[model samples]
Target chain A: MIVDLRRFLERRRPLWEELDRRLRAVEADPFARIGLDDIRRLHDLYEQVAADLADARELAVRTEVRDHLEALVARAYALVYALEETPARFRPLRWLAAELPQAVRRRARAGVTAAAAFGAGVLLGGAALLADPSARSHLMPFDHLQLHPAERVLAEERQMRAGGDLAGEQAGSFAAMLLVNNVRVSLLAAALGMTFGAGTLALLLYNGVVLGAVCVDFVVAGQTAFLAGWLLPHGSVEIPAILLGGQAGLVLASALLGDGDRRRRVDRLAAAGPDILSLLGGAAVLLVWAAGLEAFLSQYHEPILPYGLKIAIGLMQTAGLAAWLAFGGRWAGRPAP
Target chain B: MIHDGRWLEVETPEGVVFSLPLAGPVARFLAWQIDLAAIAAVATAIAYLTRWAWDLLPDTVAAVNYVAIFVVAAGYHMLLEWRWRGATIGKRALRLRVVDRRGLRLSPVQVVLRNLLRPVDQLPLFNLVGGVAMGLSRHAQRLGDLGANTVVVRVAPVPLPPVEHLTPPRYNSLRDRPHIEARLRRAVPPAAAVLAVRALLRRDEMDAAARVELFREMAAALRQWGALPPELTAGRSDEQIVRNVVDSYFRAPS
Candidate 1:
């Protein structure tokens, strides 16, 4: 059937323009609240334009008008048929007290796997160091870690006695460095879940190996007290934060692998996105706290800050973190009287 | 879910189907380059600002710079895509947008997840992983896009052709014979008519010789299908004859 293309365009141009205007307003400010009347009007306009598009498709000849109408309908369809709920305004307190922990708890299996991976690596690293001391260079690649543990402890004690301010002016800078480096690693661990979790597991294991070698080096040198004082202050929080990142990656991998689930891969990944993001966010926050502690407190030795006080603080922080993850959001979903 | 390597076709519950053009990897890579430059520029600006305050609190200033740069680098795409409805500076400039694979509004989680996974996409240097993934994927999605269930689409505006171009000429000989006009509409294929209209609209953009050759061929094809009278085609130029045939094919009885 032949359409009077000129008359059709002239008659329908206003409706198309109005729909375009409303869409631009909504697109300009995603959070804008539209009134019921406006929403109904928008819906009506969308249907009209959609019908026009259908008519244009049946035109005797294809023209740019059809393409334009399709684009319009495409935009309106996304807004009108969006199935997801509107995002709620961000509340830091609620996120911290409930959402973060709840997401972590929901993915407990992935978390366990991540922790197990790290633990296994730590054991392998410590045994390798114990059996072959000459392999220290291979096991721990850091220059600072290369120093003999006993000699390093002696130097730290000497510095403490001489009133050396090891991190006095540079603590802030050090914390910033730690925060950037740690956060990047954590993000990478989560991102590598696209590798079917292999990359994430390998990273966690490698980190564990380094840690295990360092701990064994100090313990075997008979400086366990100094090691505890130096590492526990930050490692308690930092280690778990990295593990959280690994857990997020594992969750992504599980979704990709699907195991016994029948859903398509895309659907599985979509379902896991929120939890992965939450876990990553929690890891980032914890890493920030750990970075500050590492820079400001972990660097101080016995003379400046007693080993006993630091150990207690580390233990308390660890306990507090454990409790938060275990029970923080237990009552979040409870109905009020 | 039908994809022809260039377009992704999505069907709505209402039975209306639309196609979104998938952005090629080269375009995506260029957009990334622009984004990287934008990030570097922001970081440099922050460094300069921090330098002025370095002497008073060198450590603190340096620390703030580090945090600021990291935030800018990481948050640039996420924040902009979320707020701009899936467009970053680079995307806007390139007329590309990150959209959900199912043709739905992008959720905040999807935005954050896609950008967060960018590090993996860039692994082993220069987006080699992402480039390969885009090549292999049916919908031209990179690894990050797959994880987030998103795809970047081209949003270049398609201009509506002027109505006058399709308007039936006032002195058309075809309009005098109603039976002939009806037969012309049924005889000419929709594809041929569309090509005729497009050639007419973009005639100015073509080389003069090519334009003549194109219209001559199109007119000849239309005549074979349309079977217009000798008197109607006797004096009209090839371009004019094609235009008259298109007009009759599209114009309704008044």
Candidate 2:
């Protein structure tokens, strides 16, 4: 099917291009005089887009690009009424082509209560971090020491082994603990979305700042380069995922605080569907990665990487994010919806 | 929003404004909330500028930020309106706007009052009790809009499409629109009959598609009828020229 479509395209490329160009011209004007011509052009464009989408899907083109292109065609169909009489009406429908953002926003608004709850969660996290001087130094109540308590976690690992093959039992227990703990943290991060957006910001900030402080403390304790062989296996994806979750939470909080103008606030809670899915997927992967580091590398207690290197890496990540947000190819020259 | 009877009206540069029937508590509250947010954004920006001045840009940060924000405020309003005219970026972007008491534009004085009173109308509480009240009111006007004699209303853009003569031997709306078969079914009499057929079939397709086909045929029909002005039919779609002629009726002031 793909091959046939490709051949058809190649054979008809000249005609298609001409049709596309003509339609584009009509789309650009879309006034009354040439309504017949304009509709002809639109018909031509639809056939072309449909064929391209089919071939692109076979080739496994990036999902976002494919989605956008498909959306553009459908959008063209939606507001084409304006084109009916004035053909000039094409521009407005042309503008309204992508409805995903609007749909997402409307869904979000529908779930306002959930959004509000998330917003509240973020506020709690932020307040705790900003108000608490000891937050950085103290155990998070669920981190390495307090929950596990002086190798209590390790002791529990031993019990599993006694009932079966010792190493296998211990390993299973280790994996279970890691999974459970990571789940709690991820949930915490998402929930901290309340208190407007400040809560989410505070959560991310606290995590980031604590990591920075702890690394400094560990190094001073002379476990120099503690992370070189310690965190490499998972920290890369895990830490970033945590931050992503925090960002999602932040967005949720802001919406609850009545972000955007009335027209923009179509819906609130459901707005986070895509964002939530993305965050969850990212966080899940990072959690596994974090587990790998804890089990295989973190236990080794090697010298940490140089502070300067860690700082540099962190800064680089931040720069990359800024670049993605600013000049990212995702939006290109199009104004964000 | 649906209204049954005639109401008071105000004219302005933005669009026509209608006084929402009667003021109510709920509308009043929502309006207050709207003001409250506006105040907060402005205040927060001001506070940030003050801090930046005290710490970051010692010599001119404060002045720069102040002027920059002021210009931004006015520039944003003027640019969106002069270009889009019907709505400012915030209103258009947010899907809301300020117009006359009869769904028209707010006058220059109204604009100044509504924007300038941002501080008094918006701030002073960690909560937004007043905003909710404004929203509950009929007019959707906060203190500023009410005092300034301006009305705020939801805006819908004029969707001007071409009015064209329809053409057809007969085409199915569900199927792709058939291209003109080059060989006419017959030389047939005047061009008017072909258009009449297309328009007749159009009522069946759908509101939107019908509009498109109608516009297309209308122009061709007009030409055949010898009604279109020569300048308009020079090259562009007759519908476009027609649209421009109609849009002139509601454009903002120079």
Candidate 3:
């Protein structure tokens, strides 16, 4: 059948133009709703355009004409069929109450593995430090270790109790500093999980080893009580947060290792997406709280409180964190009817 | 045409087949370059501000500045990609944006995964891994895009060819027999139809002899598809008959 090109263009142009204009409007405001009538008209116009696009397959359509029609059809198809995402209200609160614990539970295997790796590092590091006192300088920077050979333990404890001359600005900066540092380490553990998760394991091990080495110093110095007073204030929360980050990374690696075609693997990876987000977000929040405590309470209160009182407060803080993570959002998980 | 990738055909649940023209690596590379420069600029500005803050603060805070820099780098891509419909500043400048393979808006997790794996895509140096992946992949996806089930596509430039008037004829004899018309449509290849349409539109610019010769060739070739009804072709010239065929194929009957 002989089809007239000019007649086809002349007859179909208005429909294409109308569809194009409406699509642009829709694109501009993805959430905007035109009247029901306009929507129906737009849908009808889209069907007609879709038919024209298919029919254009037979006609000697110009490249420009085909391209124009193709773009129009694609846009219309997306608008008509694309699922809309409902805006999430109170996302952080929702995440904390419902998603966090669920994600933690889902990634428990990875979390256990992470904790084991960290514990091994601590064991190895403490052994290494106990065997050689000189190892402390190498394990941490000299400035960070700050172990004055000439100073007596009592003098150092007094100085620590006094706390650094942290002015208001310095205190604020100290909090920011700790928050950033903790978050960075956590993210690195998680992000590097893309490396088949080996990097995550290595990072966890390194952090644990350093911590173990630091603990050895307190033991050798006969200041285990002081160490607990300083670390327990925040370490209870901070350590778990870091372990969760490592777990998040391991989940990514597992997703990558999933057996399938690339599409199936991507689908698998997407399935793990919520867990990763929840873990990372929860860790970030915990790190912030840890940073605040490390800045204000840990450094300042260590000297004044009796060792017994410090231990009690530390146990309470740990218990509070445990209870919250285990049971924060009881009602949020139920599906709305 | 130089960097054109072939169409990717997908069948919808409703059985409609749609084709997306896959973007080529060259355009993707150019877009990446634009993004790289934009990111670098942002990093530099953040670095300057953070450095000033560090100088005033205690030495303990100095190390944290590096963490801030890392956050800026990672957050820049994730936040913009998720919130801005998958276009970063550079992607916007290059008129390229990331889209889900199924033509849906990108979810937050997809954005995070894609951006997080960017370091993997940049493995070694200068996007070697990403570029190679794009070259080899069917959809020209880098590892990050592949992992995230996303593809970057060129935004169609607008305003699409000016609207033209639709003048449906009072009667189209060919439309009466749907079976014959369908066979005819199936017979004529889309590329050939496009050539014929192009020729007809530019016929005025063609030499009279060439135009006549072109129309005769097209009309002769088109006849092989099926016999045309005499009612539609009784008094038409070969050129007129070709135009009728093209129009009949494009326009649907009421």
Q: Of the candidates shown, which would achieve the greatest TM-score relative to the real structure?
A: 1
Higher-TM-score candidate among 1 and 3? 1
DockQ metric, candidate 1: 0.58
How well is each residue in B28-58 modelled by candidate 1, as lDDT tens digits?
9999999999999999999997898888988
Interface RMSD of each: 2.9, 24.7, 4.6
Q: What is the alpha-carbon lDDT for the whole of candidate 1?
A: 0.86
- Over the stretch B27-74, how does candidate 2's per-residue lDDT look in tens digits? 334544554455457657775857745654432443344444544543
Per-residue lDDT tens digits for candidate 1, residues A195-304, read 99999999999999988999899999998888898998899999999999999999999999996779999889888887898899999999999999999899999788
Q: Ranking by lDDT, best first?
A: 1, 3, 2
Candidate 2 DockQ score? 0.01
CA RMSD of each candidate after superposition: 3.0, 24.5, 6.2
Docking class of 2: incorrect
lDDT (Cα, tens digit) per residue for candidate 3, span A23-142: 888767644766778778777887888877777765544455666776777777765654334335436667777778867876778888889989999998899888987878877564
Which residue segments of model 1 deviate by more than 4 Å? A1-3, A21-39, A82-84, A334-337, B1-5, B186-191, B212-238
List lDDT for all candidates, in order. Answer: 0.86, 0.42, 0.72
